[model samples]
Target chain A: MTDRPENDHWLVRPTTIRLLWWVFCIVLALTVIAQFGFSVKGYFGVDGWIGFGAVFGFFACLVMVLVAKGLGLILKRGERYYDDGDSDV
Target chain B: MSEILSPALILFAAALLIGPARGHWRTAILLIAPLVTLWAVWQVPDGVIGTLSFLEYQIEPLEGSPLRRLFATIFALMAFGGGFYAFRHARWYELATAYAYAAGAIGVSFAGDFITLFVYWELMALFSTVVVWCGGTPAARSAGIRYAIMHLLGGVILMVGIVGVALQTGSVDIQPMLATDFSTWMVLIGILFNAAAPPISSWLADAYPESSPTGSVFISAFTTKAAVFALILIFPGEPVLIGVGLYMVMYGIIYALLENDVRRILAYSIVNQVGFMVCAVGIGTELALNGAAAHAFAHIIYKALLIMSAGVVIIRTGENKCTNLGGLFRTMPLTAVCGIVGALAISGFPLTSGFTTKTMISQAAATEGLVAVYFLLAAASAGVFLHAGIKFPWFVFFQRDSGLRPRDAPWNMAAAMVFFATLCILIGVFPEALYRFLPYPVTYQAYVAGKVIFYLQLLLFSGLAFFLLLPLMRRTRTISLDTDWLWRVVLLRIANAVSTVLLALGTKFATLASGLLGSLRSLSERYFGQLASEESGRRGVFARDWPIGVTALWIAVLLTAYVFIYYI
Candidate 1:
């Protein structure tokens, strides 16, 4: 019931957030280059499809991360959740 | 070409020697054992070594085929490297169990018959369980139990297949079996389970990371790679494995991407790496088979190196989660370097073992015009870098410093990692040393400008993708659910629920039946008015004393009838 931001400290780090944004832009730029660079060089002319594949693969990975995070909200146990006895400590 | 016992058997004997030795000497014994075994393996003749007869069947103990020798050589090397790593750090019991496990694997490698293979296969299961137990934690005990059950299940399936094959064909030789018969399917499934194929893949992640830090390094090397060896030997050229391997490859990347535990990520990636080998086995060309073999050898070294580095971090910081760890490169520079080398090798970066080994398999797929598989494998290659190659060392060693400084890994640990790191580069730079030992003759070259440039572009771009998606790929304190959840959670819950309901229903049925029986007894007593009882005044005509007379008369009559019938 607690607000997500209130509980998760990782979301609060401004530096991390900025770094993540920078990384995202860099990856996007590379994908664009990989997709189009071969085409400009006339390397078998599969540039359009290759670009699509790269874009699709990257997004698909993003979706998986999102889905996993959502599922983790429900299924994630306490760090010691499985330790029902005294042995874990 | 000399007469000698198989190196695998000698290794087993050496393991036996270590079992009874004092603790201090046991480490020495463990270290020496593998070197001796390696020497013995080198001495094996280039033909069938020995055969034993059982009933009407012949069981070959040692076969000197190039493929078998190749696998056995690596197994011996792993034992040597693993023994050295474990010798200084592991408990005596763990050392003994590890040797036994190594012996069982090597035994399978040289086994010329299915019977010998199955026997050693089960031994691997049993001893590896002991290694897991040596973690000396309750979590390890439970995980070890589950690990044993999964492997024993695989072993049982294998046993049944072997028996069925023997019954049907009247032979037990461990030769290529490409049939679609029930027995072959059974064998395939059995091997696939150990390969950590889908639906049962969760066992590796669940059990491996739970092992003792040193134990995980040894545990990582043997079972799955041995399965790869068997697959290459028996089910080569089966197309079904292509799909199976692809599934494992993607599963490893996705799950590893989601993983927080450093070792678990590596464990998942092990499945991914083995998947490549398995897929190559499906491709089953000479090139593909060699790729699988070479990859297995290289993978064992680098993967162990990775785990050893992680093991050092865990030992020093007492933390395994990426979220809790970072910036140890400042202190543990050697470990960082070793780990990065391992990551590079695993990611198949140019001039690394993975590049030299894994590319051959992909090249085989391409040559065969399996375009879809080739593409998916290529993407998965990228994903491997995204998840493991970059993610592993990045978060553990480099990312933002958590302001916690840990010392360098121990001399022994560093030595082990350095040795493996050296092997990774040595094999990459001078692949012919490994190529000469392969099952097939060497014609493939890994280093070319086109290939190197393409691979670097692919991997580095993937690295670019991973960092760009850092927000999405951020670590969380969560364990990803895997196919094992079907058995570990759902099936187990169903079984418990059914048992509970069955017990309740049985209690109710018992209570009702007992009550009905009581009522019937009373009803009989009341309705018959105790007439059947001798104490009752109203008895039947044949009851009481008259019954005795009638019985005597009937006995005589029956005797007369019997005599008449017999005579007639």
Candidate 2:
């Protein structure tokens, strides 16, 4: 990995990253609030609850990442695992 | 007997002429054939335009349905884009064969019967193998061979199924059928194999990333989507497909999340995106079918754009792994932006093509009152955002600067990407443009307050999860295992064992035969020819001590004959 210099692009600056986090939180909160402005119609009984999309989306991604990590424990191998003569068809 | 010429024949003509034509003439053929095919795709009305009597069965060679026209139109458009992207740098043979491959896709689009479909399907298998070989490396050669074998296997199964169906039904017309009997089930499995469904999907990841930069863009567009087109026509509402589609969806996401190679990640996502289409086909409602068809049309454009951008990155940086690339947007800004547009479109961001089409599948599940499928699909949407939408751009463009600044994509490549990117946005903004082409009438509204808010929250939260688990998602110099292990490793070991046993069994028989024929072999050798080592006095045919190389040469000749007969 390349080291970040003191004076780099503004987008990657420490202060900017912090500010971006705040903005992300605000926007996320607002999406949940935006649910009240419009009725988030749900075909299922529970999906209609306020902020359900946000909750489901978060946990869904979290589960997927964890599941992938678990799979990697068994399946991941060195990049050249298929490079040897025995592996070649 | 047809009023309009089949557009596929026009592409086939171009494929034939591309090799012999010189510079300007070649350019004209490349640019004009797709335009002519595009025109013919529309000109042929919604019916069988041509037919022929093959072995007493009347077969439709050129047919047009709304679904067929949509697939053919995108295929022609893809040919135009891929040809433009590749014409400047790709080899002449690559261009010729890719056009033939596109012709195969267009032919399948218009195929009205099982025989016509099988013929075009084999054409795709034939030329696409050549395209994969055009990757021009040892890895490419190996992968291409494996790719050829896998597709040949698929082709045989499909041929067997087609023959079985013809015998059973005494008709060969394309129509909807569930996998009830043996023949239809075989047909379903055959098409699913091409769709990159599991137990065999590793071929896409195995061979596609090994292709030449521009070669992959074309390769990525046609084969699987054509399979989806077949599914939409022949297997719509196959309830079995729902379970199969769900498995494909999760499998793509899990595997993509573990991938470190940039191209492999995108290739896995192709499987993911096609999962949505396959599932929608299973839903089999008009709205659901429309979603599947529209998603396929939009998918070809955006997926090609994504691959084109990845191709540019591979060429510019001379890198394929995410671990070796980052901050390329600093120099290759246009390529970066185009890549980001493709990522967003694929993630179904509002105002992108994916959103307009993909949402309908979820809506279909909800409308069907399938509670579990609906929620799983919604979660899969978020997972798609995690793996493809955020993960792709973050690693390739926004991670630590690799400090290797390369020039942006050339004018033609940029033009191709820009063209596809424009189509992505245009389709998203005015989905009615794509909706009119669906096999079923579409009454769905893509943009509304409720839908946008829901998708936004879902996507944004998924983005949050991605960053929080960023360490887990770190790029690694590794590959993850999949079902291909059965053939690549397990089956190879088995073959070696079987060969060893056979060799042991043959030794005794060989000794007896040599003793019997020793005198006659020596006499014939004297009359026919002299051995290279005549002074050694080892002169009998079976008794002679043959050089290892001569025996190897004979084996090679036998294998060559076997391969030739396989194709014939």
Candidate 3:
């Protein structure tokens, strides 16, 4: 905090962001549990499992991010990759 | 009026006026032409309204149907919005070609036969390439070429299919058909190419990001969605589109996730959004078709909004990468808010257009018992939130402060964005109005409690994951390779290698030919050298003054030898 630059927006401050993160985490957990508590119909029966949407979404996104990471290793190139005078398109 | 011109023709006519006109007159035409087209589009009744004799066949140039009108309406509306966005900033030629491009899309929408559709399709290809060239950069020049080549190839394939179908079926009428032959499959492949379907899908990402900011907006809304319209018309429920579309969806997400260029990310997600529409077309249920149409309508608005937002950034700061942008919200608050609205709409957030339109496609899948398809679509939905919905705004406007603040969009551009943003929310809130334009009757409800809760849980968790994974998701000054590598790199490399070898062989052949010529010249010299020397030395047989008696003696000896041989 001592060396931090001036940030007029409270949302971007370290302490405020930390608090928002906690709130977001709690709300997320509650929403997931609410699905089980409400006994909502789901496309698949597994969707009815407690916190299923949460688990699925989180894991799916996690896997997607990881896959993207792995892809970046092979696919990512310098910004000038296309400007190499040959691969213009 | 008894005489009704084609809505597309009206727009095309307007395009011609853009070139010669100047200043306020041009702007007036730019803004009014779409309204005129929209008016014309709605005037006709549901049937073939106009026809022309072409090549001994009666071609329906204008037809009215629920689907055709729906597509035409949206294309016209897109022309209006895109025109509004581009009028002040874009060069006259770009605006002209864009209007013509929109006209082509509108024409395709109303086309009742393959011949008409093919002509309009090529018209769009030609004009949109010109629009890409309006970017006026070396990159834009080359990208336009690649874009043109890919589209021309697709056009050729489609023409072949159309001819084959016409030969066998004896009509060019557009209708839903099975991919049961070489002809139909070729047709499918051709349409898929325009839809940015795989192996060739990279063209969309490769070329679009190179376009001018407003140019990209116009490009995004037309070509791929027109392909969707074509699919709905001719290849609905074709089953294979489901697989092709899912690949587009996932590929879009992964590539966007890895993309550094902000506009390219948006471009990738265009493929992703189009994937939803394509998937619904594959589903082929009444609700699904409605969903596809509705989604296309909705997607045009939101995607244009997003692209416009990115365009504003590009215009304001002259930067297109997330790594080079941040804290834009401070100065460009209006742009940021509109961008977030667009992002939410695209992510299917409740009370947004995307939520209302996209869920219908998923519901269609569930109804059809496409369990695998449904779940994968569900996962891709969250991925959408991850890649575009959140990733776009957070990186460009909210990430680490790049210490750059630029002014917001110009008034006209902002108004254009606001126009679309309002529509995104309005349609989400009152979807029945949009539904009324749908080809199929609307029976699906979007606000069911169970579905709402499920999507909330899913999208929210996806958002949560994005935050937690933000460290890994840092934007860099890099580009992600795509299928374009096949042609842009691999194929080009191969071509280069072949050219180099050919050059080597060419030099070798030239050397050998020259060497052989030299040797032949020397051989001739050998035979003629003595003759020349004899002539010069005055010792040549013909040149020498020999005694008559000596010559006669030699002739007699030669005659004696000949007589002896004859006697023997």
**lDDT per residue as tens, model 3, A3-75:** 4544456667788878988998898877877765577677678876767778889899999999999989988
lDDT of 1 by residue, B1-568 (tens): 2342457777777777886887667777777888888777777777768777887889787877787777777788788877777777787778778888988988888888898888889999999999999989998999999999999999889888888988988899877877489899899999888999988999999999999899998899999999999999999999899989998998888788878899999999999999999999999999999999999999999999999999999999999999999878878999999999999999998778999999999888877878788777877887888778999999999777677789998888888889999999998899888999898898998876455545655676676667767887777776765666577667877999999999999999999999999888767665554544357665333333556777899999999999999999
Worst 10 residues of 3 chain B by lDDT: B533-542
TM-score of each: 0.84, 0.90, 0.93
Model number with the top DockQ:
2
Question: What are the per-model DockQ values?
Answer: 0.15, 0.60, 0.56
Off by over 4 Å in 3: A1-7, A36-38, A85-89, B1-4, B522-568
- Would you list the clashing residue pairs of candidate 3? none
Q: If candidate 1 were superposed on the true structure by all CA atoms, what would the RMSD be?
A: 6.9
User: Of the native A-B interface contacts, what share survives in model 3?
Assistant: 0.71
Candidate 2 lands at a TM-score of 0.90
What C-alpha root-mean-square deviation, in Å, does candidate 2 show against the real structure? 11.5
Weakest lDDT window of 10 consecutive positions for candidate 1 chain B: B538-547
Indicate whether candidate 1 or candidate 2 has the larger lDDT: 2
DockQ, model 3, C-alpha based: 0.56
lDDT (Cα, 0-100) at B236 in candidate 3:
85
Residues B12-64 of candidate 3 have per-residue lDDT tens digits of 99999999999999999999999999999998689887777788777888888
